[model samples]
Target: MDPYIRIEHLTRTYVRGTNEIHALNDVSVEIADGEFVALMGPSGSGKTTLLNIVAGIDHATSGAVSIGDQDVLAMSDARKAAWRTRNVGYVFQFYNLMPMLTAYENVELPLLVLPLTRAQRREHAQAALEAVSILTRRDHYPKQLSGGEQQRVAIARAIVTDAKVLVADEPTGNLDAESEQEIMTLLKRLNKELGKTMLMVTHDSAAAAFADRTIRLEKGRLNTKTPETAGA
Candidate 1:
């Protein structure tokens, strides 16, 4: 079968003062429909850059990225934005929650751009919070929650749109050990049970152990030395 997500000859270069910096260099990879893959490497290895490109938040200097039937690189800016809103869920190292909004309100933010009714939005957001085990704190503001709880809210917000692909950048970086385990378990469950293809960038080997496989990068290039792994 064709890859559910395919990135071919991806290269990202940016001019920094008088020199050019290569963030990703001729990288190519394919992810299966429901596979959970972890990206690991030292700093400046292009893991986040690859995820950003895949999520449509940034364009590759030269390459092609296809998610399922859609050609991500081929879309116009507006079209790509719409597609990304509907298909990609992004989780960052820091929980990027609105300080003032309640958890439910934050989760509902993405739905505002869609055509859903308020009730529909409520249903989606509520389901997402419940999935992340944060439903009871739906009315709480970000500052009122613990770091783990806040991250849960962020995950809920990401999945509220029922996105097919989840791109997480160091999702457990800001949490304690126990919280990190909890979050990784939740992510594994989401991928296995809900069939969300996941691409997670994590420096923690223990965290990467939860994924079905691990891909490592070095100096913006694919390392070609990934170790076989299984979901915990």
Candidate 2:
């Protein structure tokens, strides 16, 4: 079967003054449908850059990216934004929830861009919160919630649109050890029960262990020296 996400000779470059920086260098990868894959690397390893490119928040300097049946790099900026709204759910490291909005309101933010009625938005937002087991805390603001709880709310916001792909960048980075474990367990359940394609970028080996396989990047290049193991 074809891979759900296919990246072909992907390269991203940046020019500042006279210096040229390569964030991604001819990197190619394939992720299967419903597969939970983790991306691991050190600082400045092009991890976030790759994630943003795939999520349509950033443009690649070259190469191609196809998520599911769509050629992502081929889409116009407007089309990419629309595609991202429908197909991708991005979970940030810091749990980017609004300070003023309640959890339910934060989850509902993404849906406001769609054509759905308020009732439909409510149903979807509620379902997403339930999925993350955060329904009970829906009325709490970000400042009122614990780090783990806030992360759960962020996850709910990510999936409120029912996006097929969940892209998480250090989802557990900001939490304590126990909370990190809780968040990882929640992510695992999301992958297993919801069958969402998970692409998580994390430096923590324990976090990567929760994934089905691990893809390591080093200095903008894939590390093939180490054998792929189960987090294979």
Candidate 3:
């Protein structure tokens, strides 16, 4: 079977005062459908750049990126924004929840862009919260929740749209050891149970171990290394 996400000769460059910076250099990778993959690298190694490009939040300087049947790099900004609303779910390192919005409200934000009725949005948002085991805290604000709980809420918001792919950038970066373990377990469950294709950028090896395979980026190039063993 073909890969769900295919990237070929992906290069992203920036011109900073006549100095050319290569954030990604001819990087090619394939991620199968429903596969849980981890991306790791040092700071400025293009891990987040790759993730942002794949998530439609950034544009590549050259090369091709195809997610399923769609040519992502070819899409117009408007088209990409529309596609992202329907197909991509992004989980940020910091919970990124609104300061005033309750967990339920935060989870429902994405649906407002769609054609769904308010009732329908509430139903889906509630379901997503339930999936992340955060239904009981739906009325709580982000400040009232623990770090792990806030991350759970963020995960709930990500899946509320029922997007085909989940792009998580350092989802556990702000949590403690115990919370990080809990978040990793939750992510593993999301990939296996919900059939969500996850592309996570993590610095923690233990966090990456939760993924089925780990790919590294060095000096903006893809590195071939033995896949880390998936943790129990």
The lDDT of each candidate is 0.93, 0.93, 0.92
Off by over 4 Å in 3: 225-232
Q: Which candidate is the best by TM-score?
A: 2
- For each candidate, give its TM-score against the true structure: 0.97, 0.98, 0.96
Model 1: per-residue lDDT, tens digit, 102-174? 9999999999999999999999999999999999999999999999999999999888888999999999999
Model 1's TM-score against the true structure? 0.97
- Kindly list the per-residue Cα lDDT of model 2 for residues 1-232, writing each as its tens digit: 5599998999999999999999999999999999999999899999999999999899999999999999999999999999999899999999989899999999999999999999999999999999989999999999999999999999999888889999999999988899999999999998998889999999899999999999999999999887776963
Residue 62 lDDT (model 1): 98
Better of 2 and 3 by lDDT: 2
By lDDT, the candidates rank as 2, 1, 3
Query: Judged by TM-score relative to the true structure, which candidate is superior, 2 or 3?
Result: 2
C-alpha lDDT of residue 47 in model 3: 93
Worst 10 residues of 1 by lDDT: 223-232
Return the lDDT, model 3, position 212: 86
* Weakest lDDT window of 10 consecutive positions for candidate 3: 223-232
Q: What is the lDDT of residue 92 in candidate 3?
A: 91
Root-mean-square deviation per candidate: 1.1, 1.0, 1.4
